[model samples]
Target: RKQRKEAPDDARIRRFEDRISEGKFYLSLSSTKNDPRLMQALRGRLNESAEALGKNVAKDSELRRDVYEKMKALERSLAKAKRMQQEEECFSSKKLHASIVSTESQLRSTRKQASYLTQLAAKTIPRGLHCLALRLSTEYFALNSSRRNIRNEPPKVDDDDDRLLFHYALFSDNVLAAAVVVNSTVTHAKDPWKHVFHVVTDGLNYGSMKMWFLSNPPGRARIDVANVEDLAWLNASYSPVLRQLTSRKTIDYYYYGTHDRGARADPNAKYRNPKYLSIMNHLRFYLPEIFPELDKILFLDDDVVVQKDLTPLWSVDLNGKVVGAVETCGEKFHRFDHYLNFSNPLIAKSFDPRACGWAFGMNVFDLREWRRQNITRIYHRWQELNEERLLWKLGTLPPGLLTFWNRSFALEKSWHVLGLGYDAKTSTRDIERAAVIHYNGNAKPWLEIGIAKFRSYWTKYVDYDQRYLRDCNVT
Candidate 1:
């Protein structure tokens, strides 16, 4: 009975095992048809199966060829992936290198700018501060000089009535300049004694100016130093123009009040000095009234250094005109519009904008003719107009141009050569040939801003060994 049960169980187990094997073979054949690795393996198994089954060899060859193509495609794809990765790395490296170069260039530019700013500050700040301190000291010195009673007797004039008379309204700030002018004039004059110098200074500078002339008198020259306040004719109370000049509004307008407009309009403007509007500067306009005894006067600005004999100036007839000055028509910045505010219709209508302008540094004024034409009244009228409306911004020259417009006789340009102080481009030949070299701008020869090359011309006359100059560090 046991043998019979065991034999039946073993037969059933064998039958189940054969059915499972058949199912696995069909599943593998259907599922692995498209797989490259399995396709390659199946090719070998197919070849053996075909031989066992007695099937066609052509079908086996086709399956093996398809498997070979699939393997080749997979190899090509792997190579392309590697090449793409290398290109990306190369592009990234080049981009990073360009960025570094740009950053370095910017850094170098920043450093250069910083260095330039530092150098600019170093050059300007200390010099500007020194100038400020010097100005304050000068004011105090002038005040002290005014308190002292100093008198300088005028040199005796010979019997000749036709002697050359030179008049200058000098100031304390330009005492050295005045000295140089007188010295140079005397040194170059045909007859030194024939030349007369009438130097009128303000009250503050009267004593010092007189002392300077007395101590260092130009040989045999008639030098008269008088205070502006001492002049009996020039009563400030009588003149509305003079009163307005001392007013707070005019003071502010000239000094630092217009700095905002200047800064916005021109960053490099040279209009920094308040001395342009000083009382001494305006005194020249009162030449006819100042010297009632004189028929003609050769007015010289203190800023000038006489390079040639000024006696020749007296011989040039004014042809009945009040003024004989070098017509600066051909100069770079000597146009009428430069000095006059043509924006006001009154100014625009009153004068020609394109009219030629003349310089005042070396003017030969016919006082007789000036008084006859009433030029002083004309000057006063314009000053009144300016006060009422902002007619012009610059000091004195605008009113002068208007007063002596058609009445001036054009003198030879060689008599006065301007722009030695302001223009660095002024030729050395021009400076040498000039009869009178006028440092007409802000960079006066006495100031540190003056050109070093041109300074020697003015400094040549300065006696640096003098105690006062040495103490003041004028060198």
Candidate 2:
């Protein structure tokens, strides 16, 4: 018999059974060195509410409430823990000290469980998009083979086709969002005829992606959609990431929870985000293989919108660098130390610990330079070393920061402005001047969790008033 898949909440926390013990009971029951004041500080209530909720907290709203309560309760517990540790010789007894250590460990696990649950929900495909995918896929298959449009025509292998085209690479599984990206680019282009878009999606969404573009073709500009899974060069031997993508250990790490104590014991719970494990999220590393013929290409994340003609990016002299992108460190979080492990000498010796990082959502790549410099090999080397996550815990950002360490040219800030997803304080004048805007954080414009203030920037590109979208109630 096949084993049933466990839900995120229970799946992430249950595997940590070895860490939980009767010591939790001891935390609330014990007195700290016979001092009532000290004892009050150490009077920790350890996970009683979650224990009571058990499997009953299954609904999304209930889960949110549980997470909120858990965070509030955890905050109170952290304060109490700090006070107990701060007191002189309080709870210094061996048994009581062990209980404190165990309780802190359990609290860390709770924080991770909460983060995992939130990311699981955030990453889940929304109902409206799922409905759109099914509908478009059904419509695509209903048409005859000749009626299905793959492109304007097979790409001609001629001088005209070889001319410097405004080539773009967008790898995503969201059909509607991909459509918006293409539409926005074409709408804003100074010369749409010179532009070419290359989109890749997982096999499941391939037909849906093709159908959406077929029904709403970008006038003058050509678009080609490829099934990401069918790409020949993405096989195991070529890419370390692809090798891990098929590994049993990797599959279990994402599908079931991890068994690694260090991973489970992580204080930064955001490391548990499922996006870190997604193959599509890391596809940026293999761009040269994806489009070997192109000398230069502009890569766009599905969560971003192009507001101005990007033809000039190809003209921007990379100054012998492999990537041209806007510096993201001005806001203060996208620095090297924030994403990478400086403690590891392997990482520290090669790069600056305090170096500023750049954004990935919209970047110009000098494919020729990338190939000549063999950047892919360096990226693979780092991926191999990080299989056990020794270098960092978060997803592509760290590896991206590493891959182009000293090989990037920073563009003007107005070219690509980020933080539409979670930051509500971005200035209006700054946004108005931005050539491209990125929804980089978790509050995606599609989900209810998206910020209302920033939703307009993304939603404006979406044709929500369309009949099919209306039928799916996508608006």
Candidate 3:
């Protein structure tokens, strides 16, 4: 072959190949053989390798760049493989997490619906109780008081006995509920004869209430039922509650406002019970005036059932305190701010936000002290301040918390265990040992929405086999 002028890049590559053939950096198994045959075989392979390098490695001083490019390509391949493996591993985990989140959302929605429905059911009056009320009222109105002769009459429960007796003032419109209160009290009383109940009810339920307690006389526990409206002095002029009842703003807020404007509805809308508008709910404020003769009285809510002897409550020295109650707040949220609107300048200035709140279900009131402190007057002042509903919307608790703020004597928790109605997790041991178990929430024992476990605690106290209950089919 004719000799060709070699390019400088080609010459450099040739030198590098010659070095490798001489066993310099590159490896070749044929290097050990120094025979002519071996030399000839290597010559053919080296020419082919030199040609391959021309196509792959860039010409001249670009060798370093070529090496780095190859390394980067290898690293990219390794990284791609790792990413694929990770994606495969995480695919199932991602799916499971999304499913769990979806299920939790559904559970929350379902629980909210269930809770709202239960509250509504609790508010409804059952047919059996309605029938019982009607039957009792009919029987009560048909006969005269002389012919009626209701047991536990006036002679034993005269005004003179008020100071000496263990008095309970229960204000309720529900006749059966009132009966249960009296029954439980009388049954649990250490001395039933020493206990006297001043039950005040509205005009609609007056006859029926009087009749039920009369027909089912609570042994020797004297229950004197009276009409709340019949108290002429308790009208819009004297009582602040009655005065609030006459307020056009109060009427609109309770009657016309927040009446179920769906979608725009409040989650706590059910808690704004219309019963708060009733006089009996407010009548609890007027315990001293309701029974002016009584010096000390244990106030009982109709929803409560007496578990232990309440006579000790009468002797619980209030230590100059106007009211004695089980403090509902500790680290929990039942505080002054929870009831009153702290947004109002007047409320914020008047009270401590974290001040402990007390239960009203089972309370001991030193009516003499109440009179001395003018607690009712103070209560009326707060009511008037909140007449426009600035301080609070809920009736019973806010004004009460304000009225009896520092005036309360903290009783032991064992005396009253509450939350049986709404909170399912209320301790069974606490309920059992409780002197009084109160169904303070919407799930009253009388309602269909009542918790089954707690319902029995209330039902066991009730004598369902009684004549009137059996007649009206009140189970």
Candidate 4:
């Protein structure tokens, strides 16, 4: 009994010590009372369970660290992506803002330019035939130069040269009252013929108008002047060319007018005076008489200056072609829209640069063909229609007939460009290329200032006289 008990107590003591180490003293007696093999087996199982728990705890801690690190990385990546997206958005916004600003500036500039042009057109171009004729007369003098050579001579220079000079002279001026006259002046002090330029008053434009047949004044490219009043007559009458055309040809001013009838008793009906239209109409009628051998003739308005020599232009062999007019860059007196109303079986077609706006005021025509085709028939019919519409009112036709010829004519843009009633400044490049300078406005170089390239022409015209600037208001 003592021996068995001693062993049991020793085993019990060992188990107690094990329970103490495990922090569970209550489990020592219970474990010791259980079957020895069973207890031992239970202890073995508990050890295995403890090992599994330790592995599970370690794995859990490792998993937590990995998840935390992964989350932090994802957050940083998201923030970076957001920052990059914001930068792109900001850049896009800036570009859009810039584009809008640029577009607005362009639109404003365009609007301003359009407004200025519109105002000018409405206010300045209403002078009708008196102004029209004046302009034409002035341009004639400006384009044709006085030369020692005879008219029958072969054009010395390229005809285009004269044409270009005309363009430069007409375009160089700043306003209707201020038009430039570009010319070559050879003089003692300087070769005034080399590249002399000056401003010409509209009043003194008679020299250009009759240059086709006029003689130059002594030692000058102009005509002799007695007084300002006789300028127009002297230029038109005292030409060497007039002597040549003695019996067969004649030159005179064509006139047309309408009287008020009792039918349309409205006194205010004359608000838009039809007199201006009459001048063109009368011109159309008298053109045949002035240039009798031909069915068509050229009609030039004043305020044009020629840069190139015109001898070549007259020498151009037109054959059977009708070179009508040049295409204008700015405002057009006879645009397509205006021609639409005049459309008919004879003139229904749209404008063609080859045909319409080709010869312009400076024209070359096939007279025989024009008469055969009844070219003036349309004008006659229109005049009749106008008479029927208002018995008392003056009926006048529009210049839109030029557009009707667009299909049956030839035009040279490089050779001719109308000023469209104002002095439009151009660069030297433009001047070099231009053929005829047409001044379609009232403010001429001799009368006004601030026009490009016109001052030189004005000075040339006035160079001969100490008091040559009588008619013009030079600034």
- How far residue 444's Cα lies from its native spot in candidate 4, in Å, is 7.2
The candidate that wins on lDDT is 2
- Cα lDDT of candidate 4 equals 0.38
lDDT of 4 at 451: 59
Give the residue spans of candidate 2 off by over 4 A.
Answer: 1-117, 151-163, 255-269
Summarize candidate 1's per-residue lDDT along 1-475 as a digit string, tens digits. Answer: 4665435424533332333343335335433443455445435444443333232333332343344444334334333333444565677689889889999999988876765453343235234324434543454466554544334344355334545344443433346778888888888887776777888776755555666665577787778777778776665675656777677665555555453434433222233234545667787788877777787888888889889888777778788898898888798778899888888898888888889999988888888898898888888888777774378765777888988888989988777889887788888888898899998765677766677889988888878887566555666
What is the per-residue lDDT of model 2 for residues 26-54, given as tens digits with 9 covering 90 to 100?
25543334456534433333354345345
lDDT of 1 at 46: 40
Using TM-score as the measure, which candidate wins? 3
Over 4 Å off, model 1: 1-172, 255-272
**Worst lDDT window (10 residues) for model 3?**
23-32
List the candidates ranked by lDDT, beginning with the highest: 2, 3, 1, 4
Question: Which residues of candidate 3, in runs, are more than 4 Å off?
Answer: 1-111, 153-161, 255-267
lDDT for residue 75 in candidate 3, whole number 0-100: 36
Q: Which 10-residue span in candidate 4 carries the lowest summed lDDT?
A: 249-258
- Model 3's alpha-carbon lDDT is 0.77
Residue 436 of model 1, lDDT score: 90
Q: Which 10 residues in a row give candidate 2 its minimum summed lDDT?
A: 14-23
The lDDT of each candidate is 0.67, 0.77, 0.77, 0.38
TM-score of each: 0.66, 0.73, 0.77, 0.40
